[model samples]
Target: MESGVKKLKKGEREFAITAGVFFVGLIIFLLAGWTVLPRLSYAEKVQPVEFRHAFHGEDVGITCDTCHFFYKDGSWAGIPKMEICVDCHVYLLGQSPEEKKFVHEYVLKNRHVKWGLYFRQPECVSFSHSSHVRMAKVACETCHGPQGLSKKPTEYRTNRITKYSFVVYGAEAPSNNYGGLKKEKSVWGTIRMDECADCHRSRGKSTACFLCHK
Candidate 1:
């Protein structure tokens, strides 16, 4: 009977050790996932020009539609071309060094500012800004946040593997309680597939594969 008791105690001790090791391993895995992996997976990029939206919107009284507008045929003009900038930016209106760089480097040289696009979707995905903006009456701030009122440029982080902006995959949304990544209703709203589906469902829109996918 004593021999059997000793054997049982030995088994329990082995189980405890194994449990402890697993707990430690899980902690290490979680820590690396939260911190180290993000640095390795994403590469930060700076836009050619640090354009201030607040200055244009508040100070100069330029609206969002002024730069980003739809054509007569209802096709979305994604970004403002050099022709649009040349009209107002022929000469520096502000004392910003970036404005001087813009006038000298791009405006004078007849080169377009190659702005870093944050909402660059995959080729397979067909997103119609006209349908969303004009037909549905969805505000630009709904998906893009308060970018028009932003004083500073956003930190553009792109995933090296997917070659897409981190916003496409949905960054961690701010929350009061600790939880996994979810849709954000705050400043930087998530644009993931799930969030899109949620939006469609809320609005009673169809989520057919062909509707979004090519």
Candidate 2:
């Protein structure tokens, strides 16, 4: 009987050790998933021309709507074309090396700078900047963060699987408290579909299936 008891205790000891190892392995797996996996899933691409938003907004006193504006027909003129840059950048305004590269490589050569977009939404999704900005009076920084105040261009990171930029998922944006909504941790660093639904629900807006999806 004593030998049987000793065997039972030995089995229990083995089980405890197995469980402890499994628990520690699970924690390591979770940590790697949260940190390492995301970095592996994306590829970074550099912007063609280095544009300083702080210099334009703070130093030159240009507003957000000045470059990104809506046309007379209510359609959004998303990114400014080369013609818009020509107004101020036709000739080298500053002695900065970047300005020289822009004037010589693009402005003088009449080539459009193939700027990388960090916020290119999926084709099925239709986002109206006019409705959000003009009607709702939503600030650009609310969704885009303080990009207008950035001293350097943001590095564009694209997911290999979705071919979509990851900035909307990882970039820091203004808190949900901007539009009288309760602040949420999930809504701060993400612009995913669920977060959009949360924002709409908080604002008493419709979360209908056809609202965002085409």
Candidate 3:
């Protein structure tokens, strides 16, 4: 009976040690999230427009290059001219209201819809899109989310300011919240520099100041 009691005590001690280690790890993870994850920088979606990428990419078989603009260098064509819309919508004029809206309201007037650009680098960064798309054979969705899955007339919102990235190394806030960008007097969304750094890091590449800031 004494031996059995000792065994029970040993098991309890091992469990306590394991539990303590797990608690420590959880605490560290929470700290890292508080420090590393970028909080929303004053984001408000004007209209709840959602797109399902899988349906367009897998089911309908739409090529991304058809809509997005790519450059010859490694830089991205952030926004394409309305002519690109005309090329496709010129035919869909009477077919659907969705198509007609692009052709008549925006394209005909040569006006660009202020689509909130989600994947954006600061004006300082000089990454070329052509080299990556043409030479590297990268797909448009690699950086930008597929839009076909997104609802028509994608509403755009942006921070009135730039948020500091987490790599600011030893910064107080894990992420800098851009108060809001009221540039055009529109709604604001949470796309920030922290997102850019996170996307670059996920690809195992870092676009530090020396590399991209030109």
Clashes of each: 0, 0, 14
TM-score of each: 0.79, 0.76, 0.47
> Clashes in candidate 3: how many?
14
The alpha-carbon lDDT assigned to residue 166 of candidate 2 equals: 38
List model 2 lDDT by residue over 1-214, tens digit each: 7656455467899998999999999999988887778678777676788787878989989987778889987889988999998988889899899899999999999999988877777889998888888988877766675666446554555778877653321123333321212232112232568767887898999999887899
lDDT of 3 at 108: 71
lDDT of 3 by residue, 94-150 (tens): 545544665666667677666544556667766666755675566654444334434
- Give all candidates' CA lDDT scores: 0.73, 0.72, 0.50
Q: In candidate 1, which residue ranges exceed 4 Å CA deviation?
A: 1-21, 167-190
**lDDT computed for candidate 3:** 0.50
Which structure among the candidates has the greatest lDDT?
Answer: 1
Give the candidates in order of TM-score, highest first.
1, 2, 3
Stretches of candidate 2 off by over 4 Å are 1-28, 166-190
TM-score of 3: 0.47
Which residue pairs of candidate 1 clash? none
